[model samples]
Target: MIWCFLTPVLGAVVAEQYLGRVKTILYSAAIYGGGLAILVLSSLPAVQETVISLPGLLLSLFLIGVGTGGIKANVSPLLAEQCTSPGQVIRLLKSGETVIIDRELTVQRVFATYFLFINAGCLAALASVEIEQSYGFSAAFAIPMTVFIIGFIALMTSKDQYNSSAPDGSIIPSVLHALGITIKHKGNLNCTRPALEPVESRYQEYPWTNSFIDDLQTALSASKVFLLYPFYWAAFSQLLTNFISQAATMQTHGIPNDILPYMNPITTLFLLPLLDRLIFPTVRNLGYPVHHFPRITAGFMVCALAMLYAAFFQRTIYVSPPCYDHPRSPTCMHGQVPNDVSVLLQVPAYILVASSECLASVAGLEYAYANAPKSMRSLIMALYLSTVSVGTFLAMAVLPLTVDPKITWMYIVLAMAVFGAGAALWSVPVQRKEAG
Candidate 1:
């Protein structure tokens, strides 16, 4: 959240003082890229012990997070403003319109995921060995920085296509204009029919007071729909962040640190489209009546199942490191499947988790954007992401609690997964006749 403390305010200064959005993206990317580079360089064990103390490392992480936070938050709004039509705005608007389930965006993202996620999964499969043998964490991050630089170069080279106005081409004027339109609308309504009586007279008849009476008088009341979405997403945010580490810890008995990479790949790939070709057409078919809730519910159901699968893994394999944790020793931290139970038993659980992730997360992106209102799209999108932040925050908070019942976190994930499924199932009927 503090990302705004730097990016919008500081970036606004940078834009005014010397550069603009193009420069902002470039420099933001560079700063972010540079931070990643520094992080990688300093992660070298020798360098870490000497130069990067834990506090210093955390501070660097915070700085980097702040820079990227502002960049990403502002970038999409900038892009939308540059589009030529309300068609683009409409499309962006449509992205947030729960009444119009966004199939095109859904198709685009799913297709992108088919390629990107699988490749990411594949790379993740090889990541552990690569990290150990290559430059470790620093080198891992450096690789992405190189990619970011290339990305910056590509963005710079690309020609600008759309030249749309920014909500009236000026923030102050735009805000005033919007507010004026709203006020004029209210005045028109009241003037046409004074049977409405003086609202102030009504207030006088039933007056309620507060310390901030003046402020309350001026403010607009919020819509009820705004309350619904954040609730749905909050459930989601809790799931992945809380569950993943717990699943990992429970399954780690016989698992080699190196082989652990495959666990996630196994899980995620299982959830993703088995074939890239199937994704677009499947989504295209869903475009018929915009049955978004059903799709979202299906995703949630899968997520719930994933946690049950995890519960099984946690309950069974969470004890007595029998082998793998002691690679050189005779005893292994293995499970109770067979006399010759190999490390491979963990694959089922990983596959289960991955399947759940694909169902929950990908749809979640589509759901969040589709469900939000137009003017608040970016903020709502951030709100969707913030759920993950909340979930991760919950996870970190819950991590230490494992020492208690040691079984509580398992049930917690199960509850989130179940609650998510229930919520998604309930929301389905709302959009059944609606566009989204």
Candidate 2:
């Protein structure tokens, strides 16, 4: 998993220094397709019987991870670049009210749409579990392999539609060269001060432009904002790990245990359209600015509320009949077969987390791109994505509480931790004057 997150930094470097976004995406997609094919073949009964090996499985995963990281880093910025508008615009509504169509907000909407389709793909992938149970793992793997191949072909068809940039040839070395110039001019100690302006002689001696220095400042500020993201992601990561464990201790009635996980995406699919078309526009028309930080802060609180609900749900699961003190007991193990409370009860938590995604997840993507220098979009976005991995690592601090009755306390602690992180994030200064 760390490898999955780490590879994007390399992808960002390659994209910015060697290949532009379009070529990088195409090349990565091909690599990804090849790796998926290898995975599909490896999972086959015939291959398993003949010569399945852990090394082969690991190699496929590594290849896929690298390719995926490349795609994840570049694609959002590429899609966002499609919107030519760089600032907010005012339009007269049919209701005789004025509405501000904000570029940052528009980028947020684009990312929301992007995630909506991404979740749609997830919904389809969840369906593959049915295939895995009946037709076998080979067939299940084939489904995603086929889907990725089709997506690659579709991307190829639209190649001419995208805006592309040439690689600037190794950005880090250039940054180092500029930094050396600054250090020589300003002295090493004063270079770290926020108020220190770049010495004019340094710009003349080095190729560093005023715009580059200013943009670097913006990029650094954005990176600091990204540092706060891991808390929200750490809280969100529970849906993928611990929340699934929580679902296993509840009654599913006739539903498959795996189906409950789909609720997050399903709720996201429903809520995104409502937020984009109605709520946001209405709020803007009412003379409120839906700034990224405030929206993200709200998202953090919403996620904290979701965790609060999960804490209560876990408490209920602990006290409920069949499971009683031991949710992992022999009878309680199947969850579908023997459990006290209905799984339907987990719906509120899923819906609340989904709401947070609309606010927090989309806001993070927009904030990364909108705040970054055009040259640093993929790199900055990769840094933002890296927060999830960081948050996951941070979550290890609470690993001891992942079991049984202790899980309730775990959710409560995470709720407070995430909420506190959100408050801290809200206090961090943003470069709005620089942004303007």
> Residue 35: error of model 2 in Å?
0.9
Query: Which stretches in model 1 have alpha-carbon errors above 4 Å?
Result: 1-27, 44-56, 71-138, 159-255, 258-276, 279-290, 318-343, 371-374, 396-401, 424-436
Clashes of each: 18, 0
The sequence of per-residue lDDT tens digits that candidate 1 reaches over residues 1-436 is: 3343234444433432344445555677766766766676677677778745565566657667756654653454345444323221223364575344344444434433643454474655365457657767767666666776787678667725433222212322332343453466673323222234345444332121232222221222211222333333333333334343443444346554445435565555544555233653576577743334555455556555555554554454443343322222223334332222234454564455455455555555455444433333343334444454444344454446444235445545644745554574564333212222
lDDT of 2 by residue, 126-213 (tens): 7689899999988998988988888899999998889866777856566566567557766353352344545654344444455677
- What would you estimate as the lDDT of candidate 1? 0.46
lDDT of 1 at 434: 26
Report lDDT (CA) for all predictions.
Answer: 0.46, 0.81
Model 2 TM:
0.89
How far is 348's C-alpha from truth in model 1 (Å)? 2.9
